[model samples]
Target chain A: GESVGLHLPTLSVQEGDNSIINCAYSNSASDYFIWYKQESGKGPQFIIDIRSNMDKRQGQRVTVLLNKTVKHLSLQIAATQPGDSAVYFCAEVISGSARQLTFGSGTQLTVLP
Target chain B: SQTIHQWPATLVQPVGSPLSLECTVEGTSNPNLYWYRQAAGRGLQLLFYSVGIGQISSEVPQNLSASRPQDRQFILSSKKLLLSDSGFYLCAWWSDEVYTFGSGTRLTVV
Candidate 1:
């Protein structure tokens, strides 16, 4: 079975620095991508999403870049704050199906002061 | 605004005990419902999905089963839970745009 994976299990960053988390998805058929942030003991909150037709999309202090050629997706956060410390996950959806989503292993982002 | 609700934030069940987790969505109708399980420090795994009432699709064959009795209610159940069933169970709803996940339920089987 194909799966999505994170390049690193954990990422540490200093406050005020930019943070980037990477993901690789095995399903080439995936046409839609989304980034989610989950704080401890909470449900995942949608951060941003990008469709296959576009290469990049930006939201408040966050940007999502998708390189379909390499089946890679990355989330970039600016001015990392201690409050930004959480687990980030990327999910993929195929073209024909919007009912199911494939999720990547999460990366724990820890911000250091 | 749509919202998802999952009950029993945490549960400790003895092995072989029956299991039931309920999920409901509000402010949305005819939306697709899904159940996913995440093991400790692992990615989310799709377990089941429902497009409509009485229609259930099992993604990965296992001891788990799902049912949709109403338009916005989905249930995951097992006749006898296995020790391996211990994990975090998440309920999600999908609209035309994106999916919304519920506060997951953590189940610990002894």
Candidate 2:
């Protein structure tokens, strides 16, 4: 089965520091990817997305970088805050597959004050 | 603006009880709808999806099923639930290459 997985299950960072989360996907046919943030007891919220055609995309204080060669994806958050503490997931979608997304196991991010 | 709505924010049922979870999309028509299940601290698993009314595609075979009765309404149902059925259920609508998920329903089958 094709799977998207995160390298780390947990991360801890200072409030003012940056945070980096990594994901590896097994589906080479995946053309679109998205990063989502999920708070406790809430649905996952879309944070950012990037198509395979682009290597990097930036949004607000977050950036998504994709490496097709290694089938790797990463999300970077700057100036992490308490509100930024949550589980993050990376999802991949194969183009023309009815836009069905395969999600990775989330990484718990704890921002220390 | 489009939004997805799922009902019964939380539910508790005994094993063998029936189940029905409803989801609807507002401000959008003829959109793709999906149902996903997530266990505690785990990734989402695609259960079913519908492209249009009366059209459904099941990604995995399970004890559950889904239906699209209207253009914007999707429903998930099970005749008899098992303890394994307990989890967080999410409904989503796809548009403009993005998926918007509902708040989700927390189901506990004891």
How close is each model in CA RMSD to the real structure? 1.1, 0.8
Q: What tens-digit string does per-residue lDDT give for candidate 1 at B1-110?
A: 88899998999999999999999999988998999998888778999998889999999999999999999999999999999999999999998676899999999999
The TM-score of the first chain in every model comes to 0.96, 0.98
Candidate 1 TM-score, C-alpha based: 0.96
Listed in order, the DockQ scores are 0.73, 0.84
Tens-digit lDDT track of model 1 for A1-113: 77788999999999999999999998877778999998877778899999989999999999999998998999999999999999999999866654478899899999999
Error of 2 at A1 (Å): 1.9
lDDT of 1 at A25: 90
Question: What is the C-alpha lDDT profile of model 2 across A1-113, one tens digit per residue?
Answer: 88999999999999999999999999998999999999988999999999999999999999999999999999999999999999999999877858899999999999998
Clashing pairs in 2: none
Stretches of candidate 1 off by over 4 Å are none
Scanning candidate 1 chain A in windows of ten residues, the lowest lDDT window is A93-102
Superposed Cα deviation of residue B11, candidate 1 (Å): 1.2
Q: Write the per-residue lDDT of candidate 2 for residues B1-90, one digit (tens) a residue.
A: 888889999999999999999999898778889999999989999999998999999998889999999999999999999999999999
lDDT of 1: 0.91
